[model samples]
Target: MISGETTLDVRRRLPGVPAHVGIIMDGNGRWAAMRGLPRIEGHRRGLEALRGTVRAAIDFGLDYLTVYSFSMENWNRPIEEVADLMGLLKRFIRNDLGELHKSGVKVKVIGGRTDLKPDIRALLDEAEDLTRSNTRLTLIVAFNYGSRQEIAAAARALAEEVAAGRLKPSEINETLLSQRLDTAGVPDPDLIIRTSGEKRLSNFLMWQAAYSEFVFLPMHWPDFDRHAFETALAEFSARERRFGRVTAQGQNGKTKKI
Candidate 1:
């Protein structure tokens, strides 16, 4: 749970805001371990954080938000934990899908769909379909996602297109590859925030976050709040994204894209 703070404090602390935000929800299990709670309880708390994040993003007027829900590597966790996670996920969708739809939040799930059970997969499909026409915000959930595997899958798809004469070998370009990625049609993340102060990408989105401004928050996932979000957004807004070249424009705070 986040510390006690008045609403006025959060409003006063709000600074630069971001339009597209990505979060690596980390430290749930560690938080539980520190509190002597069951690991699944940590996941539950993380879900609570998810609710907060979604509402905050809406309140902050963010256009896109992506969360690392279940990575492909997480399959190695204890079977009981994995099952419990799935159960929680199903319950979340069942309880919140209608509300999310009403809120006009578009939902999309990225990564391998084969690993999920039929019912869960169906639920995801339903969620995405139900929210396809929504325009309020885009919420991407990366489940069974791995950066390397996503890139490989994109490569394979491109190769197939070439073999089928749908695409010339010379037609393969960054744009084509982007369309092949699981995040096809989605814009690259502008701000990537990782909780628990982690600095690594951890196979989240190698291709998508090629140049995202990063924020490493010391707070755990369950501890993050609107204030933390505002802090990260402010820091990101203060940065000058040079991409790969020096800005030819005078080094004034004005953004001059390379």
Candidate 2:
């Protein structure tokens, strides 16, 4: 916990709260190993943490929350573990879908769907469809997602358009590429939090998180709670986002252009 004095200091210099936050949920396996338990138990606890996080995000008045649930590279893990993870995913959706919908959270899953099993695809579709109208919060699940693949796919889409003469090479820009990505409708994350002391993104959102503020927590995903989130937000509030420009305060309190 931050000291009261420090909290007050951060509060005074605080910037605006983030409208969208992304999380790289990490360390379930490590957490389980430390406790002499199976990795699946850690994942189950992580789900509980996710539930609390959704409620906390709503309570904090956040608009969007993105979580890295499963990555494309994760398929390289042991077959048994992979199967367990998939089972947990199915169970989570089956058991918690109704409650999530009732809480007014719009579920959006972003990633490649071509290789996913039919049943998994159907479950994802149902989750999105059921909560399509909810507006309280948008929960983005990055399952079977990899930033490089997403970028490559987007580029291929743009190339196809150019080949078809629907778009010129000169007309292809950042905006066009972004529109082709899976996260086309979603705004870029303002803050990204990673648990388990990992400092890297691991290809979570390479393009979208171009300038997002990052908070790396020492605890694992299963241990993340509202207090941890508040701490990250407080740390973020203290930051001065210049966005490549100089602040007036840095110019002897005089307004200046970069």
Candidate 3:
């Protein structure tokens, strides 16, 4: 939670605000270990941070916010920890779905759902169906998602099309591949923020984040709040995003192709 004074200092519609932002929430276990608390407690606190961050995103007038909630690799963790995570996911949807819907936050779950338990899949489906009409903020949850797997799946689908003579081998391109991914209609993220001071994507949105600006924060996920979110956005505002091209200022006030 952010203090009232800090909230007042942060502008709602600040300049250079990214239309779409992605986050990699990390360090739940470490935060708990540092305090001699159970890992589950840190995870519970992290959930609270997530709730605050979502509200912050809405207040900031963002169109899309993607969170790396759970990855395919996460299943490698201990059984108890994994179960705890699943429990938290269920709790989040059950407890917060109504509020999210009322606030015009549409939930979109990406990644594989075929392998998830039937009940879990049902909850995810319910969240998306109920809030499909929302327009204020699209909260993308990357559950059981792996960027390599997503890319491979896209390629496999395209290959099958070519094999069936429905598409030519030469017709396959970046746009077509992007359309085949789980985030087909969504635009790529403009900024990616990671908590816990970690400096990696961890197989999250590799293809879509080709040009996204990254802001790494030293604070753990449980400590993230509205103030932290605003701080990250402030950093993003200071960055000069030129994609792959050179800016006129970089070329001594003369525009030229690199």
Which candidate wins on TM-score?
Answer: 3
lDDT of each residue in 147-178, candidate 1, tens digit only: 99999998999999889999899989999899
Computed on alpha carbons, the lDDT of every model, listed in order, comes to: 0.88, 0.92, 0.94
Enumerate residue pairs that collide in model 2.
none
lDDT of 3 by residue, 66-96 (tens): 9999999999999999999999999999999
243 in model 3: Cα distance from truth in Å? 1.0
Q: Using Cα atoms with residue i matched to residue i, what is each candidate's TM-score against the true structure?
A: 0.90, 0.92, 0.92
Over 27-136, each residue of candidate 2 has an lDDT whose tens digit, in order, gives 99999999999999999999999999998887777789999999999999999999999999999999999999998899999998989999999999999999999998
For model 2, what is the alpha-carbon lDDT of residue 125?
99
Error of 3 at 39 (Å): 0.4
Model 1 per-residue lDDT at 113? 91
Sorted by lDDT (best first), the order is 3, 2, 1
As a whole number from 0 to 100, the lDDT of residue 130 in candidate 3 is 100
- Backbone clash pairs in model 3 (N, Cα, C under 3 Å; residues 3+ apart or in different chains), count: 0
lDDT head-to-head 1 vs 3, winner: 3
